[model samples]
Target: MSDLPPPPRLPVTFRPGHTRAILLTAGVVIFLVISGIAMLLEHLGPGSRLSFILTGALIFWALAQLARVKVVADESGVTVVNIAGKRRLAWAEIVRVNLRPGDPWVFLDLSDGTSLPALGIQPGIAKQRAIADARALRALAEAHSASSALPHEPRS
Candidate 1:
C-alpha cells in the first residue's frame, strides 16, 4: 500500500436553516393542492387550475432557491452557492470576508475588487449566532490565505 496520507477535509460549511423555508414551501404546496381540489370539485375551467398550480410551483421554486444558498470553505478555498449561480475561489483570490452592521448578509472581498455576497450567513433574529459564524468564517479564510501565500517547496 502507498504511504501517502489522506487529503485534508473541509471543516466549514455554512447553510441557512431550512425550517422557515420548508414551512413556507409546504404551505404554498398545500394551498395549491387544496385550491386545485376545490376548483375541480366546483367544475372550474382548465385555465384556473393551470394558473393556480403554476403560481404555487413558481413560489415553491423561489423559496427552495433561498434554502439552497450555501458557502463552503476548506484549506484550499471557498465555494459559494447562490440562487442563480455557484462560484469557487482559491484562498489567494479572497481578500476579506466582511459582515458589517446593518448588512443583510456576509460579503467576500475578492482580489479582483469584486464583492460576492454570502447569502447563507444572513442577519436575522439570531443576530449573535450569525455574527459568531461570520467571525469564524473570516478566521478560516485568513488562515488559509496566509498559508497559501507562503513559498512552496520545489520537488527534486
Candidate 2:
C-alpha cells in the first residue's frame, strides 16, 4: 500500500478583499513619487533627498501592512497574522469570539484573559460579509471547543 499522507483539509481564511484597491493605490503612489523625484532631482539638496527617501520607504511599509493582515482557521485552531505580529491559539485556549457593534474587527477572548485582534475580518470594508465571516469563525471555534471537552464527570 502507498504510504502517502492524507491531503490537508482546506483552512477557512479571512482577509480583506481590498487587494486590488491597495495595489492600485500603492502603484499610483509609487509612480507619482518617481515622477516627482525625477522632476525635482536637479533641484533637490542632500537633506531633501534623504527626507524623500525616508518618506517613500515609510509609505511602502504601511501599504505592505495593509495587504498582509489575515486569519486562518482549521480543525486544530486559529492563527492570526497582523502587521506587527502573529498569534496562534488552540480551540481550547480561545474563550470566545467577540465582534461587537461598531468594532473594526473580531476580537478573540482567550483563556489567558487577553484579547487578540482578528484584523482579517475588517467590518468597515464590507459589513455584511464581515459579519457573516465572523459568525462562521465563532461557530467553528465553539464546535472545536465542545468537541475537545472532557466527557461528563462527577463534580468534586
Candidate 3:
C-alpha cells in the first residue's frame, strides 16, 4: 500500500492567476452579458446587479489564495494555506486534514485548540489541486521546524 495519507479523497490541483475550478463558468458568462446590457442602459450600472456582484466577490476571495495557497504533507501531518494567513500543525496536533468528498474547505484542527481553513479548490476541481497542495505542504513541513505538538494540546 502507498504511505501517503491514503491519498486525499478529494485531491485537487490549483493553477495560476484567477483560475478557479469552483467558479461556475456558465453562470459567470451569463451574468456578464446581462450586467453588460444593464450597464449600457444606465440602469444603475452592472455593479448594481446582485448576481454579478456576488460572483465577482466570490472570485476575489478565491483569487486571494492564488499567490500563497500551498499544501505540504509528511508522515506526521499536513499544512495547507497561503503565507498571508496560515495554520501549521504537526500530526500530533492535527485531528486530521479531512479528505471527505463534498466538504467545503480543507480544514486544520490545531493543537492550540483552533480550526483553520485551507485553500481548497471548489468541489469540481479538487483532485489536481489537492495533489499539488499536498506536495507543497510535505516539502514545507519537512524543511521547516517540525511542529512539536500533540493532537489535543491546549492553546496558550
The residue-by-residue lDDT of candidate 2 on 32-113, one tens digit each, is 6955795588888877877777777677767777778888998778999887999888889998888899998999999999
Model 1 lDDT per residue over 53-142, tens place = 777777777777767787888767889998899999888888988999999889999999999998878767567767777877777776
- Candidate 2 pairs with clashing backbones: none
Candidate 3, 40-108: lDDT as tens digits:
665564457666657655655554445446454555555455537655456566544443566554555
TM-score for candidate 1, residues paired by index: 0.79
**Cα lDDT over the full model 3:** 0.49
Instruction: Please report the candidate that would top TM-score against the real structure.
Output: 1
Model 2: residues with Cα > 4 Å off, grouped in runs: 1-9, 27-35, 38-41, 45-51, 150-156
lDDT value, residue 105 of candidate 2 = 90
- Tell me model 1's lDDT, rounded to 2 decimals: 0.76
Q: Model 3, residue 151: what's the lDDT? A: 48
| Candidates 2 and 3 compared by lDDT, better number | 2
- Which ranges of candidate 1 are over 4 A from the true structure? 1-9, 18-43, 153-156
Q: List per-prediction Cα lDDT, in the order shown.
A: 0.76, 0.78, 0.49
